[model samples]
Every structure is written in structure tokens, then in C-alpha cells.
Target: MTADDIARWFGEMDAELGGATLFLNETERQLVCSRKLFERRDVRYLDMRADFDQLSDRQVLDLTKPIPRVQSVPVMALMVAMYLGFKEIYLLGVDHDHFITGTYVYAFDLKAQRGKDDSVSSSGEILTSRHDDFQSLARLWRQYRVLREIAAANDVQILNATPGGVLDEFPRVDLDAALSGR
Candidate 1:
């Protein structure tokens, strides 16, 4: 999501999310901090630092420290969940197929009114803002493997509930079955 989108959502949902804590990476925090959303007394921001290329073999369970980044926000989020002591994490809509699909799409884009120039759209246009080179894409897969290792070491089960995708680092499960504890 863009900074404007985040600001607008916060403005609309500020009252309803009174006690929620928002976690953002340093870059994201900088993007939305100027909007004064952080001024809210009830809103707290956890500034997570990103480590772009390096993959740690062990789990980084400390929320106060920097988490290793795996080129995808979902990986970082999984790290946060593990840090928060979640034993099982079910990943949904993590297709990780931007290179194959040649476009960036968000799950909420169906509800958003986007313009032609919008970076995210349902039209499947290639995003010009950021391009992931072949090496970077390869690194993403390697990072996922490392993340799987870390999850195993921590005894955390990482399940991929995405219908079909290239993210095979974790075990695949049916979303309905996983949700119903089958």
C-alpha cells in the first residue's frame, strides 16, 4: 500500500482501532510518520529494521532487534509472529509470483478504486516503480529456504495455504482445513 492509502485508512479507522499496535519497517514508518498518525496516544509503532540480503540460520525472536528481510513482507511478518510466540502460521495469498505474473497486485485492490497510473492495479501491468532483477529474485527463494530452516529450529510450523504459488519453502495445506483445525 502507498503512504497515502495507509494514511487514509488510519484516518477512517482510527476510532475503531484504538488499542491496536502498528508495526512498520523503518522505511514505512518514515513514509507515514509525517502524517501525524503517530501522535495518537493509543497508537504505537514498532520500528522494525530490514536486512535485505542476509539470511540468518537461527531465528531472530527478539522484537526489539532488527529482523532479517527475505525480499517479501510476509516473511518478515512471519518472523514477527514467531517472535510473538505463535506456534503455527498459516500464509494466505502469498503467491510470490511477481516475476511470473509480471505485475504487482494487492488483495485489497478489488475494493480500491485505482487509476491508470496506480502502481497496483488489477489490469496486470508491470510495475515500473521497482524491478526485481534475476539475482534478487533468486535470493528471495534462498531466503525462504533459510526461513523454513529457522522455523523448524524454533518448532514453528509454517503452512502455505495459498491455492497455488511458487513459495514451496513451507508445507502446503488447504485453507479451509487449516482454519477449521482439521
Candidate 2:
């Protein structure tokens, strides 16, 4: 089945998108994550938190009935995908260098809104709104190494779609054939 099709079989729009896949994700942003291509299958809502099994099977995405799955760390999303019956997780924008290095996809000033309290407002909640901007690129590189090592140790095959950067680290695949199930 197509990756998108597989996604539908596994989870609905309110389900989790693996952490590695939340690109430009914010509670207020309806941005489509290139890595988690399933969001493109239909419109998705940015939830700033992970609700975990709170959504009913028959639930629909709307004003009253919302999908409980929210923005979470990459590992959380990956774990959820494992349960979704996806045999192979194809990554389209697994650009490690972008994060491992100092050049994150985008930047924002968190300190600007230092004292904003989220007590009564539900709509104001920012899903994982923004990732922690690591001050030390070197530290991020170390964390990245650990993440890669964990993936390698687990033998969960990751295919990088950028066609550049360090791809030889993971098993390469003829994506077209895989998509066609050839």
C-alpha cells in the first residue's frame, strides 16, 4: 500500500505524527510536514500536546470532536508509528545536518514571551509549538549521534530522501519501486 494509504489504515488525522516528522509544527500553524507526508492526505490540526489513546475510533476531526494526538518528541511519534502497522517508515526530509548543525529550519525568540501563563486558555496552547533551540551545536551533534546510534542498534531502517548529505549510513532503497510495491 502507498505510505499515505498505510497511514490511513494505521491512524486518522488526529493520530500521532512521529517526532522526527514534525516540521514547522505549531498549534497555530497548519503547516504540512514534509517528513510526515500523511498530514498531506488531509487537513491536520496542530495540537501542542500528546493526548494518548484519548480519541475514540469513530471520532472525526472537527470543532467539537478533535483528534487527541498532539505534538510530541520524535521518539514518541516513532513509537506510535510502530503500532500503526507501518512496516517501513520512509522519511522524505530526514535532514540530520539541518538540526545537528546550528542551522535549524527556522528560528524564534522564546524569551520574548517569558511570562505568558497557560492556565485557562485552551486555544492559546502552543503544541510542541517550538523545539528547544540548543545553544551548543556541539551538544546537538552529540545528541544526534546518540539518536543515530539508537536507530542503528534497533535496526529500524531509515531512508533519507534528500539525495544529499550522509545517506550511506542507512540502507538505500529504490523509492519508486517501493511505493509501487514492485
Could you tell me how far off, in angstroms, the CA of residue 146 lies in candidate 2 after the best superposition? 4.3
Give the poorly placed runs of model 2, Cα more than 4 Å off: 1-76, 83-86, 98-155, 166-169
Shift in Å, residue 9, candidate 2: 29
C-alpha root-mean-square deviation, each candidate? 4.1, 14.6
What lDDT does the true structure give each of the candidates?
0.69, 0.40
Off by over 4 Å in 1: 1-20, 27-34, 38-57, 110-122, 127-133
What range of 10 consecutive residues in model 1 has the weakest lDDT sum? 109-118
Tens digits of per-residue lDDT for model 1, 1-182: 66677666666555455766666656556656677765664433454555535544576457676655457778678877887888889999999777677776755533323553454455867655445446666777776777778789988899999997778889999999978989
TM-score of each: 0.71, 0.32
Give the Cα-based TM-score of candidate 1 against the true structure: 0.71
